[model samples]
Target: MNASAAARHPYLSPDAPRVLAHRGLVTPDAAALGVAENSFAAVAEAHAAGVAYVESDCHLTADGAVVLFHDDDLRRVADDPRAIADVRVHELEEIMSERGGLITLAQALDAFPDVRFNLDVKAAAAAESVGRLVAPHAERVLVTSFSDARRREALAAARSAGAVRRPATSPGIDTAKRLVAARALRRTTRVRALLADLDALQLPERRGPIRVVTRGLVRDAHAAGVEVHVWTVNAEDDMERLLDLGVDGLVTDRADVALAVVNRRGTTAV
Candidate 1:
């Protein structure tokens, strides 16, 4: 989005070349201290490291609570065979207590009032609740999902919750794909149409073999008053390269390093 439009959305008002901590930050030291991805500790680490945004995912528990977790099951993080939907919120919290301390969507918003959240609706069941939870904090939250319908559902829920300002959002995979195709074909009209409603285009630098976040795409998105944010980028060199290409933001596991890079460049959009 343009500077003024972006400034109107508190979540995007920060200076360009933003860095979003992907699933929060878990350095070797933090991991050694029992901090886990998407855990409260991880998010706290990112916040302490001075990241403007924390990217996370949400799921619904059997008790209908919206939690900050990435996977459907606890296998990788908890070593439990049960799925998140099958467990009660209390049980899940107990399990995460040892890993890094579980954090509900409500807790995250309330505990870190100044931190902006980039939430992905990982479960359809959590969409409405996520919407409801973030409604009060719409100015500082960005709701997203791989499913456009789910994303829209959460945004609608936020609106229904009486949020005067709509939460910021990025397009889902389907819309992103169409936008990419339109960009590749050089259809300015179609590209603008695709980006009209989006605040950011969160994407990979490349999808399989085809490059997704090219300069042309970034330029087109910026021209349409949208920002482009590349995801899951971790390496320092790659972060610098992408920034040099004029991307508006980077979603990285290493917010620590990204912050350092950005500082060295003086917050310039590049």
Candidate 2:
């Protein structure tokens, strides 16, 4: 079990390098495939393919229900310009019925009893609700966001909801920048401090043209007992390269391909 780095956060699979189905497998031909991102059908498809970890985002609806959705509004999926926060949960369901059935946070949790979810709290209003909803299943859920304040707010809410073990988390955008600086300066103390409570560094392989994941950063994170995971990595060659480079997880839109790559790669030396 390569679980030492994430020992505190057991949601990460130890048997193999992790593969997180980013928004649940909306492939390159998503419209043709009829796979809607963050929809129940997508998640079901992921599980059916034997993928264990699913990464999704959360937003609150007008009716106060927390949903597994990605966008601020229904523009892309439903072709409606109305904001998701302006629509009720049932209304959102109806909007998504044909593309892919929408699932509430509670329903997702209840239904996928064995799956580990990496949930991004996309909306500020949904932060507290997300934390509370996942409190009981803290061990099986990872909570994160781009905003540090929003991310911490959700974690704090989870703690207030009586979560004993902290939910696994990644640093937000601001915190990530701080980490990058600390790494570049080789400030071991600052890097350790920045990574104190984090389980993984979930990042894009690059931010614009600046390469975000590097050997130095990965080494530093590992020395601090944290794992590095790259997001939305899609291509087969890219998957093999990143895994070979020692990323602990891959958050990908092509989980089927990722899984096959991981299997063929077959636990290479870390």
Candidate 3:
């Protein structure tokens, strides 16, 4: 574990380099045992592996239940041809029962009371409900979406629901793009302005050939009181390299492996 940085927010407290289980953990062994991503089992396994953070996407069912799921349609995780918005909560639960178990936003929060969640509001329709569900638990939840408008909508709803503390947030695609431009131009004031309301800069390491999480980018993000977290990194070498680059977090499918790497580095994250 790296030395703890100054706490930026409650969600980011004890600010050491950390690992966020991407969609929870579905290791090769777990997958072989019929586990599925974003299932309750996946998150349980990550928790069992001692990971403190989990990243997942949220969608709303037809009956207005917020579920931890990725795609709009069921074609990928479930072989069903229907859209999630067309299915009732119980029906979706039935489908997920065999594949590890359905994990609603509520259930995940309740079950993993000690873990922090980084939830992506995947659908515009699910945004408000996701916010409402996460409201009371706002201190441990981070609401985000690719659409800046959608992300803000959820945050607004959380406030409406009387969140005790504002949830942590990351920039959407547009804001991230603008931030990158500001960074490239060395506009110090503009960079801070762009990050004024954000807690983390969660991003891909690169966009095609354009590297997004460069040394300077990491430095600037840290200077602005935001932590930089790279997404979808699974390989051990990549994990090691990114940690060396001074990233604050790694969003990976292999939290188990990440923990091992972190341990090997002699920096166990609290």
Please name the candidate that would achieve the greatest lDDT relative to the true structure: 3
Error of 3 at 133 (Å): 1.1
lDDT of 3 by residue, 1-270 (tens): 222444577888776778999999998987987788999999999999999999999999999998999999899887889999999989988998878899999999999999999999998999999989899989888989999999999999999999977799999999999999988898889988999899999999999999999998888877778889999899999999999999989999989999999889998763
Global Cα lDDT for candidate 1: 0.90
User: How many steric overlaps are in each model, in order?
Assistant: 3, 0, 2
Candidate 2 lDDT for residue 146: 97
Worst 10 residues of 1 by lDDT: 1-10
Q: Name the runs in model 2 displaced over 4 angstroms.
A: 1-6, 27-30, 268-270
Q: Could you tell me every candidate's TM-score relative to the true structure? A: 0.96, 0.94, 0.96
Please report, as a residue range, the 10-residue window in candidate 2 with the lowest summed lDDT: 1-10
Model 2: clashing residue pairs? none
TM-score of 1: 0.96
Model 3, C-alpha of 228: deviation from truth (Å): 0.5
Tens-digit per-residue lDDT, 1-270, candidate 1: 454653445678855788899999999888888889999999999988888689999999999999999999999997899999999989998999988899999999999998899999999999999999999999999999999999999999999999988999999999999998887788888988998888889999998999999888887877777888999889999998998999989898988988989888887421
